[model samples]
Target: MLQASFGSQHPSSDARKVADWALRSHDNRQAAFIIIDKRAARLYVLDEAGRLRGSTSVLLGAAHGDDTVPGIGQRAISEVRPGERTTPAGRFLAERGHNGRGEDVVWVDYDAGVSIHRVLTSNPGERRLARLASPVLADKRISYGCINVPVAFYETYIRPMFARQPAMVYVLPEVKSVDEVFAMAASPQR
Candidate 1:
């Protein structure tokens, strides 16, 4: 709507609604915005004016859901159950920061300890990288509620936009209705 071009058409109406609403309503339209489609296992990046910068496959939580345990973020991974591993759906004001491992990441839900980082290829059994490359998005769910993307994509697009300025993130809901998770007035029909 701002004379900018959008690249991916994969985001559902819910995701697109939230992104559009943010661009039109949020005061800081100059900053970057991101939309993560959990159902699609895709990440969409856009400029402040709503033009798509790039998009790529991503890995999400192993389980499917839109809510996280109240204090699961602080618990050790070993103690967390499989079903509890979920990426919450909502709007997040993401910022860039370094994790304990000294690797750069974009914290989407800080309180939930959810962040977007380069895909980890250390665990060959998990086949994380292979999952991301799979044509079926359902294969991409193998992380611990964190979003894992390609290293080049993160360094090239995500880090630059979020490292300097805060960005908006909309994680589309998979188990709940968009209205239930994000009550923003949806974009008007074309």
Candidate 2:
């Protein structure tokens, strides 16, 4: 129960629920944080005070699972099956870093090779840009576990937040309950 406000931005019910829990329980550790609502295909960036910094639609894994397949990160991208591609749900202490390509990214789970970076338009056939612009939720699911955001959004919101310190990223589960994914010591059922 946040007495004040979640923020000026209007997030989905699930996103607000997780954000409220994180803020009330001090789960964000006074750091900037993000809430990714998988079901809604949206991402919310908030400051330490739980004020909305920005929000945007994002591209998630092609698969619908909340957990990543074991050892999938160790394998080449080409070897990963469609079903193995999943942006795992849970809280991640994410940090800003660069990929092998030297592009800046917010590493959600470095071990899992999951990061939040600008959308890739390398393959026109994938129509990543088109998918991003589409209002359809299903069109947003075409990434390989990584979270893809618009270039401007990534630069203006996500990058600066993680440039100096690590931040908490809570990816809400699609198949599991919020309680199951977070299991916060202070979380009470709504």
Estimate the TM-score of every prediction.
0.91, 0.93
Q: What is the C-alpha lDDT profile of model 1 across 140-173, one tens digit per residue?
A: 8888899999999998999898866887788889
Candidate 2 lDDT, tens digit per residue, 74-139?
Answer: 888999998888999988888999998999898999988999999999999999988988999999
Candidate 1 overall lDDT versus native: 0.82
Worst 10 residues of 2 by lDDT: 1-10
What C-alpha lDDT, on a 0 to 100 scale, does residue 144 get in candidate 2? 91
lDDT of each: 0.82, 0.87
Candidate 2 global TM-score = 0.93
For model 2, the stretches where C-alpha displacement exceeds 4 angstroms are 1-9, 186-190
- Model 1 segments more than 4 A misplaced: 1-4, 8-10, 27-29, 186-190
